[model samples]
Target: MSSADSTDAPIYAGLVEEQGDVLAEVRRVAEEVLRDADRAIDFGGVRSSAAYR
Candidate 1:
């Protein structure tokens, strides 16, 4: 049988579910860093003039 059809599919699915928490944490960290960077660029006038167009 294919890997997807094997009995281990349930175990693999559980493993994937367990990763959701890590994924959420990673997303939160990335968003916080990006928000800080955006604020700096917005207030520091570091963006390119062409971006205003």
Candidate 2:
């Protein structure tokens, strides 16, 4: 099947992240993992907020 054919597919993904016991850091770790996985992408820089007009 073509990639687009799977567009409606659903995934069962989850994270078993725990800290200090796991730092319990949620967004931080997720973003780090995303960056590592997409090393070719330059996320530019941290953005606080954006406005579209």
Candidate 3:
């Protein structure tokens, strides 16, 4: 959904490129995959999900 801004850049210049890719992937998963599941867990409880078994 939302893209990272320049201010979101990592502190270590050497790791900037690598960390940026990693951060993007992590954010993508959070917004796409985990978003709904996170809400479900908060409302229904983690044990209610069959995947948690």
Candidate 4:
């Protein structure tokens, strides 16, 4: 195989190994956003009142 083809496997393997970290970071950010949204709803009282309209 050529050098380019040989390097492909290791590159792909490294990406697979790093997938968990990537997913964890994504989940962490998503949870933080959701938590902030919940806090906004609670403190702003937008759910009980239609003040947005």
Candidate that scores best on TM-score: 4
Q: What does candidate 2 score on TM? A: 0.29
Candidate order (lDDT): 4, 1, 3, 2
TM-score, candidate 1, is 0.43
Which portions of model 4 miss their true places by more than 4 Å? 1-13, 16-20, 43-53
Candidates sorted by TM-score, descending order?
Answer: 4, 1, 3, 2
Number of backbone collisions per candidate: 0, 4, 0, 0
lDDT of 1: 0.77
What does candidate 3's lDDT look like per residue over 1-53, in tens digits? Answer: 24465545444454765455676778898898777886666755555786677
Q: Is candidate 2 or candidate 4 better by lDDT?
A: 4
Off by over 4 Å in 3: 1-13, 18-20, 35-53
lDDT of each: 0.77, 0.53, 0.64, 0.80
Two-way TM-score contest, 1 vs 4, winner: 4
TM-score per candidate: 0.43, 0.29, 0.30, 0.44
Would you give me the overall lDDT of model 2? 0.53
* lDDT for residue 20 in candidate 4, whole number 0-100: 52
RMSD of 2: 14.4
Instruction: Write model 4 residue lDDT over 1-53, tens digit each, in one string.
Output: 99998989787779869775676788999999999998776755656577766
Query: Model 1, 1-53: lDDT tens per residue?
Result: 88668988787678779766566689999999999998776744545665787
